[model samples]
Target: MTGSPALSSRIAELEAELAELRAEQAREADGAMLKVLLDDIEKRHAVERRLHRAEEWLHLAEEAGRVSAYTFDFATGTLDWSPSTLALYGFPLDEQPTLGRWLAAIHPADRPAVQAIADHALQHHGDVDHRFRIVGPGGWRWIEDRGRIVRNEDGSAARLVGINIDVTELVELERRASLDGERLRLALAAGRNACWDWDLVTNQVTWDQQLGVLAGVADFGGDFDSFWALVHDEDKPRVRAALDRALATGSDYRVEFRMVREDGSIRWTFTQAKVVQDADGKPVRLVGIDSDITETKLAHLALNESRLFLVSVLGASPDCIKVIEPDGTISFMNSNGQLLMDIADFEAIRGKRWVDLWPAEAAPLLEHALSEAVAGRRSRFDAACPTAAGTPKWWDVSVAPITAEDGTVERILSISRDVTDRKDADDQLQLLNAELHHRIKNTLATVQALARATLRSHSDPAQFEAAFSSRLESLGKTYGLLRSGPQAATLSELVEAELGPFGGRSDALAIGGPEVLLSSNAAVSVGMILHELTTNASKYGALASPGGKLAVDWTIEDGNVALSWREHCGDPVAPAAPASDGGFGSKLIDRLTRQLDGKVTRVWSDDGLSLTCRFRQSAD
Candidate 1:
């Protein structure tokens, strides 16, 4: 407007033209906006129609599904059950629901358990999906209840929402299926399984294909009389009676009878039947199974016969035969064994420890033999084992290991034979032989000692023979005395035998002593000593001269035999004193005294030679 009037006037017309175009554009935009708004309304209406249809379908599904929805308000402590829930509990649509009425509908037997489960879920904010029985207007029904805890922002349970479903039909189907399964299992357990069905009202029979094939009749008759014809004539009455009892009581029928097969052979069979009843408890049908038990029956009979044979064989054995368990306990003992062990009743000892029956002192021996057998080895022992009645007897026992299938020792068989007589005879024989051996050996030893002494004293062979023969004669006499008793000679006997040759014939010999006995071995030692002294006296001292005298005396001192031997020469001066360690006579006397376990002391005086010896008692 300030630039020029003509420019201002053109600008006004352009402004009006721009205003008209903007206004027309606004009108077009308004119409398009209205169209968009209408389109939005149509889409919303379509979604709403789908949603409403879905809700209606849901309600119908809830009714048909036998399910009811429920919600419990935690704060208000109010429970709301949907219309379907009321119908499930047999309540009218307008019935007011109450907690007490809901509780009363639960079956008495299931109330405590259901309440416990509900309480646990509530305390732990847990989900619940379980089934229980309830008595409703529709009668006893099974209910499947499920619930989820609705949590607030803080995760606290604000409400419990769940559904209840009537599951009575499902429960009944499960129970019937379980019963049928049990019947099938029983049929399978029966040997040579076959099935049959009989209709009581029509008296008609139906056989499974397996039964017909087994009966040798693919086109088997479908009547009660045809089924009865299969049973043996002798068993017909008993089987009919069983069937009658089952029908009368509506119970099961079981009987074992004989049936003639197509091969014209009679075999045993076990037949069992279940009676089916109608709603009024009337027997309507009989379902049964037949199992052939011929093989089993024959096996049992054979086993019994075998057992009798084994018992007879065992009874015939005289020896004590015992069967021991792997644990070293008595399992069985044969009749003869029971008598031997003094057991009146085998039952009294059954399961008793086998080792305990033996004496405690013999436990070590018995246990050692048992271990050997347990290690799969055979063992034997001969010992004096007494019976229960305390009768002493010796036995020769053999233990053999009995192995099982796995080759481990499972049992032990012990056989004991009485050996008392043999043992006694052996012991007596041993004692006699010992006595004979001692006598022979003693004689030989004495001969050797005499020969050695004589050779030591005499250098000439003839002189040695003369001296040795004389000593041998004295030894022979000593043996004669020993033979008079038990390989032993009295002290007096030994002394007299030796001195009699030198001084017994004359009054010059003197002897004094109490009765003292010496063993055969000790007698030999003392005899040698006496013989040496006599020889020495006869050669040089007393027996060499007429007036020489000899005196020998023995006494017990300190539980030992002490012997004193003295010689008188009848000369003023001592007969030249015998060399201490020189002559054979002196050495022989010293050695023999030591052999007697005695010490010797000698003194030479004006009289002659004096000697003393002490020897202990001995046994040959």
Candidate 2:
């Protein structure tokens, strides 16, 4: 920590030099020559102080920002390397190298640029800011050298001060980045481009090779003016104004402007620049790259056109197409859907729940389908539903789940078709078939009865044919009327249909019964049985006289049917004849009663005959 007394005395002598400088400035104001000399000494002293302070700063900076320092004294014709700088090159301070020795230590490939930069600074008295390579203990390393010439009192070059930063890693990263940028620029420049830079400190401009080409310059020619000259007249002012605002606000730079190409054709170019600021918070530089996004713009236009086409198709589709969520929330509905719901305003129905639009009974089915769809199942179902105005309709619906990339169900695609008309037609056909079967069965029975009756009575074939056809036709009409009831025909309707041919007025037939619904089979069987009984009665029972009246009563008791028929007046009462040896009418009634799984009881009365039949009663 201690220095020789002579070294300390040398420091005191340097302090005296500073004192002399102060004294000279104060005492020799009127002596122009003295004043000049004093100014010169003071300048030299300041340089000395700066050199000392710069040395201290270099050490501090080396530790602070991991950089070192060096200088070349042209007056002494020697290189003064700081201890840290020498240490960086693997040289100890006592073994300090000469200027030529240090230069020789630089890698051969880098020495040329390193020497040239220093030479240029000495020759022009200007500053040198450049990068060079130095071979050290750590192998070849990058060094950033920035120096300015210090002039002597006699206006001669005296010294140079510079800082060297170990920028090996920074340089490598920069090299890779530069390569990447070059690759990107070349790839993007198959069309055209304009690259620019704005120095916030000096407001100076820089351009790249593509800028000249985009501006129609035949060659780069290393000129900035060429780029400015080709800026379109309409875009020049705007670009200038934008740059001004960017500088003032330190905001990101972005602009789209037209630049004339080499062939004098104009193409739009877009540029986006980013500013780098100094420690003082002032933007020091901006680097920007320009590219043509024309194809991207054109694609957006085509996409819009395609979307319009799809929208038109959706609006016109015949099926009641609706876009709905898995939970049955409706998002969109086509024209057919609007019509099906009787909604003239589709907007009013948007976002409504699909189940709410359907009959309440259908809600459970809808919920089940939605749950299955969410579970990733495809489901389909058919339902009879009432619409908004309570008009019943049938719909066949299909649903499938659509999922996102992560396999989460995102939407359910549902399609439904109204099949009410088809269903109605099918029901009508079934009814017709059933009715046809009933008619054929009754007609066959009638023919059978007529054949047997004609044989037993020795009637002629023509008479049998006339009687059988007439009776069967009457049965056919009766069956038709009974089949068309509100729900199921009443016992009275059944009797009237079968005996209407007998001139039985409404008042001539009496009916009493609890309400019951008859299945089609039961209806047909009951009608035919009544027809047979009435046909025989006209010839033998109460209905045979104008004063005679028929009474019918029925009740559903303990799930079984009890029915009674009373025939009075037309014929005199006779004792019950045991089972007739073969009356065609008797046989037919017996067969129908058996077909219904019932029993028939006949009572001979003075007034008429009463027939009662009991059977199971079933609902349709």
Candidate 3:
């Protein structure tokens, strides 16, 4: 349908205008869409930057704290680990994450329990907190794991996410601390000491279990005053003073005191304490240890008494007793020893070497003896000790080593005795014994010779018996004279003793001689000669007649002795008989003269008989 021209033109213009407005609206909408897209892109970039920063912070936190994050999927049996988690497990990034691999990383000893714990947490959808060890390339590492389980829709366990922390250093420190505590306890037990702590502000005391045992109490109340009251009355003031001094000077306290036990018995205790000071240097607490020392104290006292007794005994000894140090110094010498050395002061020789005390000639021997004794051997010797007075004295010395408990030589002990008098007496006895032996032998030989002669001279048994008895009686008298004197007999004494039995009258016999001491040999020989001569005169020579007379005289000259025997007023005598064919009396005179190393002469005359003999005057 054709409309009017004016209406047609307006409709056309309206359509064109509508077309232009629609194009403008479409351009505006496209520009708005571009603005929204740019805003979204900027917001995403900001979020990316923040995410990068957060990831870096988390990595730094994990490394600093030694922590690693892990996730486990139960259904898939898979494990996921962060970079730090892999490093903690000693696994490289290229290694695949799996439950088996994670379980393999756990220490063999703890694997079974760790797996069980993880399994229980997964099944029960429970939280997990466990500490365990894991094997790594470096070594074993302790791990503390904490995680929360995620459940599925059916309320069953699904997954686990957790953090793992390396606690190796912490575990090692804890273990060391535990060992130190145990060592301290053992030390206290071994020492039999108790540890105590006292607080000054609260006046409260704390004691270890050992202290309670020492106090003889099961439940010890930590009361300071009560513990002080247990101290002995004599020791209380000392203990209090020590504590006060320690507190005032902020120093360590040490004291030894006595305490009364529950049984009312006394016990010695050694206590030491350190004052714990505050910031202002005021004492706040005291820490100390106490030990029982009753046995030690008693032993020391007993040792002192024993030493005193030993000194007393040594001083009372009569022998020359000395104690020498190992170095040869004279450590101790009794009074007798000092007197033996002629030293008035013991200090003069106290520190002197033992060898120096003796003469130089005996020093070597003394040194050898000391060395032997120090080597733990006993030594003995006889030595001539020159005293301080310069007199040589003989001594029998003995040295013995004194040993300590450890089998080492501690000192040398020496004892000396004077033997001079004993030695002199022994020498005298020896001389006398030899003289007696010689005299006995000569007497026996003479008796034998006399018996033989008597047998030959007498044919009748009765006559022979009387003659032998008379000779034996004369021999017995001579022997008695020899025995009466110590060294020798006087010539006059011997003559009187032998002749007194026959006829001691001056009218019948005359005896004259100078005073002379005859040797033992000479005395015996002279006595026998006189006895024979007297018997002969009495029998047949001169004394047999009433008017008979006998003369006997002796003289000494130039160490020679001359003796004469004369008889007169008797029967006429015959020529002197040869000694070989002489009777027993004549043979005896010849033999006795020969023994005397002299000569005998017999002259026969009508008036009487005369005899002369000469010998050395061994007679003193």
Candidate 4:
């Protein structure tokens, strides 16, 4: 095909023309294919335009829903804020906010954080999620922003797409809740209260450490239902009502109930709660407090019961019961107690002295009784009691001790019964018993003499028996002397009785001691022991010699009663007289000493035998 010149020229020219035509045809075909491709591309771009428009509408819708979008071109140092973004910045929708102006709207405190977050996002080409405060036309608003770095093909951050939401209301609500939480924390710390948080959506509960202790549940192991189960059956309904009311109307809730502790103990508690809601007014959380009041309630109830019992017992008593302080104040009086003195004015009697209410004759009796009672005696015989109305009354007064915390006798509780009606009968009975005892003792003495006389006349046994009869007569005489009254005889009377056998010369035996009166027990033991000792001495020691003389002396030493009997002007006592077995008289002396819880000592001296006995000076 590449041949000759003429032929070649003609052919070449023709070929060149053909080549041109082929090239043109090829160009046309290529142009046609390109046109078709361009048409298809334009159709696709038109569809994408429609989608892009729909996406823009979606973004606008989101912005209308309290949201705004923003973009920052860091390379160009430019910012583009949507209408919502402008409005969020408190600027008109048409207003254009520079990057610096937009940043200025952020709270100064949060600006650094926002910049740091942006810088990090730009540097790492990473997503950023942040919240900051901004001052706007309305007030300080909280803006929660989220954005992603738009990276260029070279992996460098080119732009930032972010959305800012006005979370001012939510943040304010959170702040209020935080304040409430702080207040509740203070209250709990002061009162040792417990707290609870309930999540309605999750149906779960969180309990403070103390609430777990109150409910007796493990702090971390209980659910809301589990905690509710611990409420006492009687209080569950009320607690439930409180919760329901709070949830229904978002009102404050308050209820008091009992809870069953883990250890099966019951506790009274007061609870209060408030409901928290979302922006849509849907309940989100319940915050409450619980306080234990069991101990206080129980103590109050017990005190009430005790007071009632005390009042009842004191009131119902037939005898007059009075509480009188050491200072002579009548702190309390039963009905009978007030009536006893004809004192209707309780106020006047309150601070008045009890002694001031006594009649002249009864004053002595009252003083004596009070003195005896103050000496730790439980009771005393009051011959007479003076009344506030000038009446003379007799009472068998008994004073019981009421000690205070400091170990002092704080009050004297007196119980007195009116014995006026029975006084005559009691006196007559006492006289009759004393007469009967005296008569019987005299008759026994006479009978003993008669029996001795009969035995002696019948056999000579009377001679030995007469000695015993004489001693019995002496004892009868002593008894008659003491039965004269409530007072027991003195030591002088006792010694005189025992020495009567010695006749007129009994003066040879001297006796001395305190003038104090002897109690019945002391009088009896002393009389028996002295009588036996005198009889034994007459038979074997001092009185056995004509020149013998005895001296008896008694005294009180410390709290003990001491008595000594010594013999003089007689044969010196023999130490080796062969410690004979004790006779009945010696044994009697020992027995009497034991009965008196006393000590007896016998000293054998060159002069004679000296005997001393000591006994505790008590009424026993």
Candidate 5:
């Protein structure tokens, strides 16, 4: 080829320089290899580029795989790590790897196991595939290390080269998978269930063989018609409608229905189904489970019936009946019980502590009752409490424990009967009985006094009997007035009891007095005094003969009763002394008058005997 002038001149200059280089190389050594030196330079540059590319690929592989290569040199007792390996331990890239840092980075709990693996590998020259943990500035990470130990001829570990791969996510996934498996196992073991799959578009149903066992049949048909035939006739249409609605709304389907078995016995089942939808939210399939729930259903029904029966019994009771929880809270109260308690809304007081519901005055009693019940015993108390409407009541409350099958106290029962009326009646009865007893005792003491006086006055048996019997009769008449439902008797009533047998005003006997009520003591004493006078008058006074006149008058003055008695005997009167007996009658009069806390005075005149007495009447 012909060269241009500039090209020719440049080639001539290169040849001239090449001739001088050849002469200089001949003076040196190996002048014949100088002609291939340019080709060798080209090859050397290509090798350098390939080495740079390879290093870039290695660094990328380490970073992308979350991996780092490690090397441990036994001879130097030093460890070497790439930049990624140092970063994995939370160390700066400029930090050099050291044996101490490497060993310290291992988790304390995992260190011993790792050491054992290393020791075994050193002695046996074995391959290692271990998983462990390491902690750094970055919390902790799980690492799966796989490596082979290079050994010397004597089987001592010369070096260990391995890759550390982060496996935290894989470990977590495995743990979750294990837990899910355990849950599935527990669900299957909890009950007898028959699983099914339904293809909505194909109208096909696939059921497990357990369905036949539930239906009391030897074999079950796999088609939808066979499964539908097992459903009770009354429930089929409802079941179909429910399924349709569930699919329409893409919701879960739950139903409880009856299944007639082959033996004509009824069984109950609960079914729950889930719909599988496509990407566009259209239903594609249904997966369901049919669980045998006959036992549970029957028990629930029986429990409900028992509860109803108990409710009826409590409703029929006239007393307040309450059920308390173990925590001493009111749990249930019958409708009638709420009415008796005057609680318009039971919810207002529900869950309130039973002790808190009582008045402070009755809290101690209520607390004691509750403690007794909690200890599995019975206690009773009678206390006064007001209702919710503030009506006062006396309640006879009986608290008993309700026990569970395990013999533990499960609840408390409180039955309160209103006893306000009964309590009042009992108090009144006690008071009447006490008063009657007291009066009877006093009467006996008075009788002793009458008998003693009669004995001293009349030594003869016949005379003594006549006087004592008459005195006893007068005392009896006095009590008759006192016993008439009042605590005291009228003064007039006491006087008439003793004087009625003698005569009225028609027979020349006069009696007048303002109405006055006297206590039992005053009545007894006054009656005795009047009787003594009457006995004397009838035997020796005006009543002893015809044409004799007798009169008695009384008045209340300054809280005291003043009485006057007079008589006209048709003959002139003698001295003011007893004419019917010795001084015994006068002495008896003196003694009874002293008992009245007053005095009796007598004045004799040509007319008759004038006797008057003054004393205070006791109200007690």
Candidate 6:
């Protein structure tokens, strides 16, 4: 609407003012809108920067942790893998990813279980956390996957997004640690050892089931004092001291002590412990194992007793016994053995080579014997072992192997006996036997010659028989005296033996002789002579009559033996004159006298007959 001129001017001015105001209001509204727009853009830039930083951090964490992100589309059965995931699955980067390929990358043996778990997670739309093995060009790798299933609006499975981590090193470490723990447990069980842990502050003790069994306790409480009380009275102070020292010095503790069980039986325990300390270096815990060592301790005691018994037996042995090591060194020798070896001090010969103790000539033989013994064969040899004083002696040495429990040759046991005297005696006996054989052969020949001559001197068959019988009897008596004596005989014994058959009456026969032993040869000759004289006397000289008397005497003069024979109070005897057939008795007397290297003279007197013979003494 238009106004009057004066009114219209004012109205126009007011309208102008109102229009300016409106314009100003409009300008204010536009500036407020621009401010709001600028604030929104800055806020968006800040959010974008924060998102970028978060992404960078996440990528850094994934790389540092060897983790990879992956996604699987359930509808298309498609799989997507990060670079790291592809490397883990041994898939080339250029290769297309698929669910089938991912399943194929799983270890054949683990594929079924992995697929079932993944299918369960997909159907349930649940989260997944699983560990599985993947086979690749690099052998095998362990993977830890954690993800959640994404669902569509209708709750059906859509896809799976997850992070895969290469946990091969961790898995290997866990496997090795588990194996080591199993091995340790097995070893402890085999050794009859028990594990224990102690809390130093509370003085509380914890023991495994094995420890309770060892203590004969059905249910052992964690009372430290009860265990301490189980220690033997004699070992309590020692055990306490050891623990104190270990705790004070932060050192390992090891001790062997006797423990008293609930049944009052004693057991040997070997404990090894490590002290665990806190940051302040104060001991807080003690971890250790206790091994039952009663059997081992008893065995050691038995071994010591056996060793003592062996030493006693060796010391008392009569033979020289030596124990040589496998290297031929003399390991042990008893007192008796040392004495036999003429060594006053055992230490002088100890640790010395066994072969070096023998003379050079015997060393090789001893070495060979030792070798044979070491090879499981017993060897025996006789050697001349010279003493330290240079006295030669013979020894019969036997070498035998001493074996260990494993049938390995541990040492050679050598036993020696002295046989020097026995050897000498044997040699002497051999010589005497040879001489006796020669003497017996010569005697037989002489007897044969006498028998033939005796037969030749006789005429009548009956007379030849009687005369040969008497002569043979005389020869037999001579041999008997020589055979019964030891290399020699006394003349008086021969006379007594020859006259024993005639008469044993002292009044009828008189024999006198000095104590003279005759040589083996001379004794035979003298026996024959005595036989002849006694026979002649008994037949016709003195012994023929009841009142006849015979006297025989022998004397030693200047190393010569003189013997005389006289007959009396009997029918008078006369010497037979030389004839073609002289009596065999006479011939025997003459031959025997010549054999003695002596002379014989005969005198036929009125009262009696007398004969005298002289010879050099030849008895040894």
Q: Please, what is the TM-score per model?
A: 0.39, 0.45, 0.49, 0.39, 0.46, 0.46
Error of 6 at 298 (Å): 2.8
Clash list (residue pairs), candidate 5: none
Candidate 4 on 564-620: residue-level lDDT in tens?
A: 988774564344221135644565577668777898888765566688888866545
Q: Say which prediction, candidate 5 or candidate 6, comes out ahead on lDDT.
A: 6
lDDT of 6 at 392: 80
User: What would you estimate as the lDDT of candidate 3?
Assistant: 0.77
Query: Who is ahead in TM-score, 4 or 6?
Result: 6
- Model 5 weakest 10-residue run by lDDT: 1-10
TM-score of decoy 4: 0.39
* lDDT, candidate 3, 365-479, per-residue tens: 7898999998899999988877777877888899999999998999999998878777667765774575456446545545564555466667799987887787678767766
**Model 3 residue 429 lDDT score:** 77
Q: Which stretches of candidate 2 lie over 4 Å from their true place?
A: 1-80, 116-129, 146-430, 440-565, 568-620
Cα lDDT of model 2 by residue, 460-510, tens digit: 878766665665576667768656354556566776566654432456677
Worst 10 residues of 6 by lDDT: 1-10
Off by over 4 Å in 4: 1-65, 73-77, 91-96, 149-159, 196-205, 213-218, 223-289, 301-305, 308-316, 319-620
lDDT of each: 0.76, 0.71, 0.77, 0.71, 0.76, 0.77
Cα lDDT for residue 409, model 3? 95
Query: On residues 281-316, what C-alpha lDDT tens digit does candidate 1 reach at each position?
Result: 999999998777778878877998998898888888
- Number of the top TM-score candidate: 3
